[model samples]
Target: MSTGIPNVSPNLNLETKDLKTAPGVSLNENQSTVLRSILDLFAGKPSLPKLALWRDDATFTDPITVAQGRDRYAAQWYGLQQAFSEIERLHHEVTDAGNPILMDLKTRYVIKGINKEQTINSVVAVHLDSEGKVQKVEDKWDGKLPEGSIQNVSSLLDFARPMWWINYYIAWAFWIWSFAWETKKKMTADITAQAFRHLNAVTVPKLVSVPKNEEEDAKKGN
Candidate 1:
């Protein structure tokens, strides 16, 4: 059975046959066949090692920072992997959306995670080298709360529960607001229907009511 675990560079062995084809405006049949073979080898393979080789030590190229060293690339790769794992979890959820994910349109990843009404959104930027290896991966985090909700309480809450009173309060507050908004909408619709019914019931004669008093005699002076 193929283990779902990502094949890290330490275990994967790259062969010359695994090299990617040269991208261009056009390629002859010979090139196409060679490229196909190369693609078949590299397409599904992990390229973590290639990414480790290209990272700049001083720059925070990814969401997490890594120190400069012989092993710095490995450290950076691990950081990126962590971020990617987080994103994977998010994409598993279906309720959240609108995540931006790409420098080139060719590669894209979107993530959305929902716990009750709370949602976590993340956009990941990824780059691939000519060898079809992962060159870079970056991540940004976003928290989306229900309407009229504050961040204080929501931020304190754990994955499943919050020890803070404010978290509970906010949860209840959102629930009430959501309920009230729906109730108000329904009430408005009902009231409008009732008003329409009353208007429909009024006849032409009823609408033309006789004047009660005022100038009763002056108006008839003719």
Candidate 2:
């Protein structure tokens, strides 16, 4: 079946670090297997399939918009395969912060149909269901253009051109708003935690019982 997506060359190089399961992140045997399979797929293992890692209702979100369903998510990868001639995983790190696992990766790839190669640094926050399938993947990447005098918008525009400028601006606005909101929430939580720590440290001594000698002295005076 032709997906209307361009086929990439098979000689893509993907260098990744050893996958480490995060501590304190509770994952069953099935979940662990799923996560390992996903890492292996991205690590350029030809035997591992990518589509099997995601659930039927999986959702993928990037800077542009959110794509729902496993097919839509798979389409996103198809787009990547079409766009990049050579993809390399510059760095990869996985951290488990309790529930969901966080994967941070830096990638550099040569854009197909364009003469210049580009680099993208991205962080993917993955959520898994009980059965170990990927339920949601939230990806945030630095989409800044590469540093060079040569500008090639024609090739990209030929592929996927924006219908309207309004949609582009709206996507940027939503991204900025979401980033600010998350930053504000994190700061507020940190401030609240600091206040509680300070209050406990200062007030805890007063709540403690008086010293034994002082109490006895006061009792004698009474």
Worst ten in a row by lDDT for model 1 = 92-101
Best by lDDT: 2
- Residue pairs with colliding backbones in model 2 are none
| Per-model TM against the reference | 0.24, 0.49
lDDT of each: 0.28, 0.46
The per-prediction CA RMSD against the true structure, in angstroms, equals 29.6, 26.2
lDDT of 2 by residue, 91-180 (tens): 766666334667776766565544345555766677877655678876666522112122323344345535523354443333233333
Clashes of each: 0, 0
Please list the residue runs of candidate 1 whose C-alpha ends up more than 4 Å from where it truly belongs after superposition. 1-60, 66-70, 76-88, 92-120, 143-222
Question: At residue 12, what lDDT does model 1 achieve?
Answer: 24
